[model samples]
Target: MNDSLPGYAERLDALHQALAADFRAIIARLPWREHESILDPGCGDGFFTGLLAERLPRGVAVGLDTSTAFLEAAEARLAEQIEAGRVRLVEGNVDRLPFDDATIDGVFSAHSMQSYPDLPHALREFRRVLRAGSTLAILETDNVHSIMLSWPPDLELAVRQAEHREIGDEDSYIGTYFPRFAPRLLAEAGFTDLQREYIFIERQPPVGEALERYVELYLKYLAEQTSGRLDAAATARLAEIGDPRSKRFLPRQANFFFGSLQTLITARA
Candidate 1:
């Protein structure tokens, strides 16, 4: 777990609890079965990995990530299960997963793959480590499209400016993040029986501690994105956007494209 991610972890935990029922409803439609070993790539802080371990059959869950901070946090959260030998955690990058070829039954990632510098290389690695008939599920935010749709005009401009100032590449992190044509990627990776689905998760306004944490995370993200070059004006504008008392309420709904999260049912020739 990166020290940077714990705050986001707290926010997501709040999200999981608040939306547990809805999340379960969505998971119910996923094709999971008993005793199938699953790999959670980029298993940040182990939240989703713990969820899968609890839901899937016993003794068949593994979490792999690059952040030592996250792996430590994940181990702590799943300590009891680890003691019982029901879960395993490994720290490694997705582009060079530390696993044997054709070993895993399935793979799952959420809101993490977009950070990879080389998407195609990482996708190829995903295809490499899975068994011939294994599956891979990826969950990522369509930040480009989603932000444009949901953010206030002023806030959106700030985000764009911040992007330009920082990366000099508008799509640096989010370019091709969602895999709009997931089947094409799967096909390129030699996957078959490809199916994709889009799920819209409506996030209500954050409240109390959760809201505070959310605002902080947003600010921190902007600060990092701008490399602290975010001027006083941009900082002030972001504060306004996050002000709980402001009339411009945060968008009540966030459309999270789930196709990337649900693709790759099995490998192919």
Candidate 2:
């Protein structure tokens, strides 16, 4: 339980692999054009930013992260793009972007804003940097609990409620209120033509062995995150339910759907 959480970057790399398809699909929905300059706020490993650069050939993708370590890794991961002048890695904050007003053509943040201390302030900054009519796409999930599991709806709700109290609104756990909250925040930030799409990848839900591996990986991290906050029996119960062979899995799937809302939202600046 005392282990440091600095190793989280490795966990994110695993996540990128698991959700790569969904990532690509979400990016495809954006209104893309040649030479469009994009900002990837909180671009951890720059994998997505590199992908963005690859897809946009002539376009530029500036990846911003708080960690110099992550930025170095990004620089290495995006070597080709950087060489081609399509990628730039910056160590910066979302609430206070480094670019001048109305400088960037578009802003794309994926599962990153949850880490921002002030969501409204970050949105406002994003609005400031983006040119008039430029697009801003944000993809995040607050329903990470009981997803890819077979447990009762009540059990899922219970877990979600607990996590909500523990990890109020952080990168590891942002609760389900975003479905309602993000729109209001965007509207108030002067972003118009707000379009949101609730993306639940039911067509390719990780099942069998894949589901088992993901559940194990996520549960281990969750156990550490909630260490002293969770009772022994509660922690044990999570392990039991996460097991693919557990009897509760099927019933849980029946009680609730087999997917979570990995939503993608877009707004015009």
TM-score per prediction, in order, is 0.74, 0.80
lDDT of 2 by residue, 71-188 (tens): 8788888898898899988889876899999999998888776577777788999999999999998877765522554455565555656665654443333323454578888999
- Per-residue lDDT of 94-195 in model 1, one digit per residue for the tens? 778898888887777666656678766777888888887666776555655332234556666766776665344534643344556456666776778765
Task: Give me the runs in candidate 1 sitting further than 4 Å from their true place.
Answer: 1-24, 146-152, 161-176, 205-208, 223-235, 243-269
Best candidate, lDDT-wise? Answer: 2
Candidate 1 yields a Cα-based lDDT of 0.63
In lDDT terms, how accurate is model 2? 0.73
Candidate 1, residue 242: lDDT: 55
**What is the TM-score (0 to 1) of candidate 1?**
0.74
**Candidate 2: residue 19 Cα off by (Å):** 1.7
lDDT of each: 0.63, 0.73
In candidate 1, position 78 carries an lDDT of 91
Give the C-alpha miss distance for residue 176 in model 1, angstroms.
Answer: 5.4
CA error at residue 164 for candidate 1, angstroms: 5.4
